[model samples]
Target: MLGSQTQTPPKEASSSITDKTKIKARYFMIWRWHFYAGLYVIPFILMLSITGLVMLFDDEIEMITYQDELVVMPEAMTLPVSIQLDKVQTMYPHGTVTQFIPSKAIDRANKFDVRLADGRSVLVTINQYTGDILGEIDRSDSWYQLANDIHGTLLLGQWGDYLIEIAASLSILLIGTGLYLWWPRDHASIAGFLKLRFSNTRLFMRDLHANFAALFSIVLLLFLLSGLAWTSVWGGKLVQAWNTFPVYYTWGDKPESHLTHADLNHGSEKELPWNLEQSVLPESNQHIHGAYTSSETDKGYVATQNNINIDSIVKQARGLGFTQYKLFLPQSEKGVYTLAANSMGGDITDPRLDKTTHIDQYTGDVLVDVTWDDYTVLAKLMAAGISLHQGDVSVFNKALNAVFCLVFVLISLSGMLMWWIRRPSGKTRIGIPPHFESEGLWKAGIAGLFVVAVCFPLASVALVLFGLADWLMFKPRR
Candidate 1:
């Protein structure tokens, strides 16, 4: 038997071996994709986690860091909002009052956003009790604001936003592939799924990495989706447009306007709710000879009405149950007074209390008022997600987010440590996962990739480049 030519294996055995080989190849292919995604995402995760942690505690940090301005002793009596605005104006007479933020607590100062005649903006803080000019802070130069800017766009504006959006999109693939790799197979017990191994250093890091990733996968995905909703392409052009409120219906007769809520936004701070950022700010009807006259415009005709001052608008806002809100003054003759109190501005801890109202500058009529109940299902989810993402909902939420960010950091480092240990010794080239030619695996992957491409344009571009690299540089040696 030893000397005889080896008998041909059974057809079933041959097919079984081929099937197993295909499965192994598919697993390795997924691992390769995971490794590549992690490599690209590691730097971004580190940056975001650090910056996110800072932003999560922005209020606390500001209270401590800018104590002279942000913190004050409680007094029995406080100055009127109008009087405080007047005092601030007296100090910065050349500055135009853009926004008035009333103090939420007795110990806090009322803040006035002033745009100077020289085209510079500053946050003028006034002692609510004594009407003393506590300090003036250049909002742009705020440390927390810089952290926020870096978190949102790396301070590179649109280009940075695109880079971050792409990273976030690819991170989805990374999470998916990580979960697959973490899935247990042929396990003797639940230890692989639940217990982290510590006998070996490599095994410990591997298990830790896998476990943290698994634990925060859903949270990370929600955070990415919520963050992406504020992006230019997918969130702005696609999801946001689809979920926006029908202001025409809400306003009854839509007023003509050339500007949108986006104009109110400054740097990394979103002054309006995510759903209404692109909404057209309704303009007031112009006054004409004290007669109700019809006017012709692109939208339609509107009757002329009596105009009112900011004092009246402020009174109306207070009467309408706006306690701690931001009142944005009209930017132009026709611009409406925009009053907002929402999680976006960190004014309220509860997303359900989000309220935005557009008051007609000329008529003093409420043009459109949107509350949390008015948001679409998707929009509501986005609002809540953003609140949680920012840790503005509650103290518990803040602690949870802090833990999540720390866990993300640990996961990232553990992954790198595992890779360093497992990588080939003293090799100039990165030890790429072994390539196994499998048409079926590639076909499935391409199909899924097509879906991702459709959803994320920038990520699709990155994927294309990665695909080209895989086909050209990482092709199996002959």
Candidate 2:
């Protein structure tokens, strides 16, 4: 009995040691992942945070930078829409006016997006009452537009988009692993929950990094998921495809044009609601009234006052209760006029008020009209979420997003600083987290990898490659 008792105590002690060893191994495994994720995501986080801030406050920036063009004196009476178009056409005789953005405020200058003869798009600002040419800015060259492009595509087109998408996807894993590391193991450790400590240099940086992460984890995740909906592979091809607005229900057996609402977008700058991007546009030209024809005038070839002219379109928009809106001109004879008022176009602050109406270019007949209520549940969420992400909801939203961006930069910098401070000096190798080899250590992470693969295929591919490289180059210390 004495021998059995001694043996039982040794067995319990051995089991306890084994349990602790596995726990430590798991910690190192997660920490290693967190480290690499931070390493790759650091630069991207900086770029995105900066560019995101620029985009979030694009209106304010433009107000300061282009006040002459964006702002004007308020007048009691405004010139007619056709006259404005005629004035713009007189200035750019060879340019194709594709879109007209009308400001609801009387003091703001009206905008006309014209494609010059050289195939460059420029936004021409025209005074509403006086019809004076304020100025023309290259749509792609504007600071806000450039920042928006970089924010979405990194100026590398599809390749840049893919890179950003990969970084964003892996960031999910970063947040997950970070949360796990921040989680307290016991009551004593719980004191540090979201509390920043500055007593020691390492602890200060650590606390800053971890605390900000914990503080903004939920909001950051919301941003990531909503932003992912714009990605080519995961969001566009998958989630977007699945949740795209049902055109059949709205159009009711009408023939669809080859072009979609995506054609309305100017590169990465989306002008349509998320669910409507893929919606098939309705064809026109079934009722071409002779009165609704284009004519050449001394000013320029402009749409005259007719049944389907620019004036009628403006009236139609107003009749439909569109206050601030954009009119996308029909491209071809069969193209339909698109009147859009949505948060995506920065026309309104509330996503619930989003509305898009397609009008027959020749007949002026309403083809299809979509409102916020027409959207699917997921689409509605995406619209509001996107508005929130862009800081278009309210002044408070802008302030919160700005704070988040600033803290994100701080967190990213602190993470890199901590890594740099801890890394071995004058060493070519990164001071990777210690690795422990235990039976099924790799297996423990398989479920997570599978989930990631299912949700984000590109991120999973990256994880696989990273895991293989780590296994080959860095053997377990144990």
TM-scores, all candidates, are 0.91, 0.93
Best by TM-score: 2
* Candidate number with greatest lDDT: 2
Q: Which regions in candidate 1 have their CA more than 4 angstroms from the true location?
A: 1-6, 187-191, 247-250, 288-307, 426-428, 476-478
For 1-478, candidate 1 gives per-residue lDDT tens digits of 7789788999999999998889888888888888878878888888999999998888888788778987678888877776787788788756677888887887888898888766667888899888899998787887788898999899899999888988998899899998888888645324557668878888888888888899889989988899889888888887998888563344556775767787897656887998887777777655522444444432122233453655677889889888878998776556678899998778888889999998876778788889998998888898888889999888999999999999888989999998888887543257677778876888877887788889888787887788898778757431
The C-alpha stretches of model 2 lying farther than 4 A from their native spots are: 1-9, 186-191, 247-250, 287-306, 425-428, 476-478
RMSD in angstroms, all models?
A: 4.5, 2.9
Pick out the ten consecutive residues of candidate 2 with the lowest summed lDDT: 297-306
